[model samples]
Target: MEPATPLMNDETETLSRMTPVEAFLATPASNVRSETPQDPEHQYLWRCFPDHVWSQRVRDTSSWVWDFGYDIQNLNGSRRWVCKRCIQNKSPRPRSFAEKGIQNANAHLFKGHGIWAPAEATKSAAQRKAEKMKTKDQRSIADVMKLDTRLPREQEIANSLVKSFDRKHFQRLLLEWIIEENHSFSICEQGRLRQIFEYLNPLVKITDASITRKTIRHRILSAYESHKGKVIAALKQSSGLIHVSFDGWKSGNRHSLYGIACFFRDENSQPRKLVLGVPELRTRHFGHNIAAEILDVLDAYGIQDRIGYFTLDNTESNNKAMEVIGGELGFVGSTRRGRCFGHTLNLSAKALLFGHNVEAFEEQRSDQLTYLLRSIQRSEFEMSSDPRIKARKPLDLIIDNDTRWLSQLYMIRRALTLRPFVEQLVLKHRQQWEQDNRSRRTGNLRKSAKEPQICLEENQLTTNDWDVLDHLARLLGFYEDAVKTLEGDGQQRRRKRGWVGSYGNVWEVIQGFEFLLEVLEDYKKLASEIPDAEHFRININLGWEKLNKYYSRLDETPIYYTALALHPAFRWGYFENEWKDNAEWVTKAKQMVREVWEREYRHLQIVRNSVADEPVAKRQRKYYNPFQAYCERTRTVSGCIVVGGWGQ
Candidate 1:
């Protein structure tokens, strides 16, 4: 049977003359040809005539069905119109609106979507006006047109959707708002909040249950699964090597979570950073245990063999982890390990603050902090009469985070600024202590009324201590700026000196080490001349030693020199100018970089085809090299040759 002819000229002309079955109009013939080639952005708007049979894709203006749905064939592989609103809002979503008729689509839209056709809306217009007259915002269409500034086309589409409430879209926006603002999980569970939502839409829970904590959690997890799949697929498609940066952190609940984040050039050649996983660490955090955890994640993503570099905090155990991974994965551990630049600077900062055994000093300070801070806040030992102490700055003290250098700087700086208040606090505590002793000796103090006197001896900041801290904060500021430059946050000014790309890569490490070393050396030499600063000469020397140790360790990896040499911005010229005085160091750096080049790139001499020239394939059959894997993943090798003594 043929599709019913379109009644475009007058849809209602035959309404009075035709039967109810014949009232449905046919899908447009031009649409049959036009809809096959879909717009990339609007691919959901399809008109399918599968098997050359009409599935009743009616385009009747009188029936407002198409406004709230999409052609299901293109949307989700169903050859029918499906309600998009229902799918977004409903927990157990309806698949399609209708396959052979408009009546089902009409019923679903009106019931599930709370949408009314123009004819039905017209019938209830008087009743709707009586129930609630259009408030202060309503005006005549003529008056609205006089003030309307939108283009005619924009105005038409806006007016059509102005009354149409998309419950799913609203719910999604609300969920995002709640999550972004860190709102409580039971925000939507309140009785009043649910009532407000019911009055606002009247269809918030029509197709699904109320949005409870369970619903929110489920939705968030579902989104996580969806995004995880996309990230895995993107990683697979990425031709570049995947570099991973991971660290272990503890939550408030004391749960140890090892967070693994990956960085790689995506399929579009865009740099992408994403957290791959945060697996719980139940076992003791040993080098071998950390390696096993990282290996599990890499194996799950199937990128274990493609590992490029591991950037981790500088620690004995972490270094051991690199060795373990290298032995198992067949790579040079020394060349692949990248000491986190921030942690390198932080070690120097720690050396400057705490002379030696930084951990021991910091741990003891932490234990004393509880009682020390409480004594400072006591009413009888209140610091000063000056309002500035209480009004300006935060009332609490700043504690240093062992991993972050800036925290130590902030702690020292805050202590220096609040010195006067601290002095007054010491005086108050001393007076209170003397009074308590007198009362105890005279037998005038009641046993029930007595309380232990708080002490502030260990916590007092001295004049000499302030002088040392003042200098410490100033010097640590230089390291803070270097950290910013390495993290790519210094891009707003002139292009970062050591950085080459959008985000800082391996190329920035060497130059950053040089800049920070210069600052430390300059300060170390001046420590002898400065008054009250002689006490910290030992601190400045300790910082210098710690920083120089890492600078010297740069030799263990050939990548540092290689990345610096290959950068398009400078190449070997940067090292030539910077290391003009150190000719020996320059020569050694050049030799290391050249070895990598000859071993990887320059060894493969391409020949079009002498019978069949494919050195990459030939090498794969004979033995394995990491260069061969890169060539296979990122480039096609049609011809190649390898000569003896390539590196030599």
Candidate 2:
């Protein structure tokens, strides 16, 4: 049931007429934030409404409305009113935001929650809906679009998306939509798309030229020209060195594309991660070849001079390509290279799942799985004990791909879950084979000699194999948390290409690698002594060897060391204590930081207001003596400096 529209009184009318800014300036600041920085009572709100910014000022200074509402900053750098009581009651998305002023919020509170407020003149949701419908009916789509309905510096793009009847804009938009949606370019020149455009605006006539290879080339060039200038300008204005991350991608149509991305800080000191290009790679996927292609993209973006470190998966070709690129860009390639820790972890997991020859083992497992699935579903056998369930039930066995290792783990986990049915099917096939052989020996054969047996030991998973898989799954599960921590979900910022942050840093890579090494080494040694786990020993060692290899390779780049030393939580002291057992190791690490500092950051300087800096003390003036009152409790004592998990 809809609530009645509130009658607007003189007070509510005046509040509605006040500008959003004026209303905000009139609101009083809340002392709660300074007193309790954590704001424990409303901590969960952060998770529930990540898009909302908690404001200091409570709204409606004239009444008790301060307890019911909050003022927050919007994306456009303005104040918005949000109902506090409604959110407190666990409403996931309360319709309480008042963009223009506090009028709508007050009305919502009175209409929905029966809260007292100056909402007499404010309209209800239903009333607003009715007004919107009336206006929508009276206006045409083109006229509605023509209205200045843009957001802060954002509305023009929406209007520019379609020019009401501009054929060029329509065609360009059509081309972009098709490619982005993975639709073939041929869709653009097709009659269906053209027919839709004609429906939208009969004044527009889409060109009916058949989309060929040549037509695709022309349209793509047009699209690039439209977007290339903005990308170049952004790269130039970037405040930090533009780091590059490139990898190969295979599209749905079986075309190979080089995915190139840039990571840096924008002019506003905000992180920016942007994809420069995904051009088709026509040449062989060799290291030098990949290097040439990447350089082409950097050249197009004009960011070669601004190149920083490279982050990539554990691909051997990538290392070689980096060397080539580093030489061209004037740096030691290996020093500039940093392996993607996520990919490295994935490979290590693969080693544990599949023995030494990972690819060969993976192939056999997949092929045997298909055979097992088919043999069970055949008319001759049943997948379950209840025969009425039907053997032709659709079963999907996911095959892992080269790019994603999680898919591989998913495949193994799924196989383990279906092991019961698999075991039953395999046993049934074996029993049938044995019975057939016995009949033939007794001169009472059930079938012709030409018939082949269905049972094959190679295709069946042994009890031992299942045990190995279970252990591996348990072992790798611990790494999942580490992966999530590093995979910061800041993709939205990157897509906007304006500011990038929350992503993993190179500083944690060495520490993570070292931790995993300790874990793997301990596991291998501990399990080697267990008599029942002999097979486990081989695979565990294989995985450990792979991880250790990459861990050592991290030595080639000082960037990882530099990143670690720069972190206040884990500075040079971290290395000294961590490598205390090996004095030479700590000495060599010190030299690496020194070299990086001299080569890159030696001349950098910062101006500081040293005089204004003061000793930390109680935030509020009401608090007494602070440290001065406790002077009698303290005495001068000699102590060693403790830093970065280290002490004398």
* Each model's lDDT: 0.62, 0.63
Pairs that clash in candidate 2: 7-120, 7-121, 8-120, 8-121, 150-155, 271-500, 272-500
lDDT of 2 by residue, 7-106 (tens): 3465356456433322322232241333244443355455555576756444445433444566566555566666664454445575556446566665
For model 1, residues 75-123, the per-residue Cα lDDT tens digits are: 3433566565543333234446444565677665544433444433332
The C-alpha local distance difference test score for the whole of candidate 1 amounts to: 0.62
User: How does model 2 fare in lDDT?
Assistant: 0.63
* Cα lDDT for residue 510, candidate 1: 79
Tell me the lDDT of model 2 at 123: 57
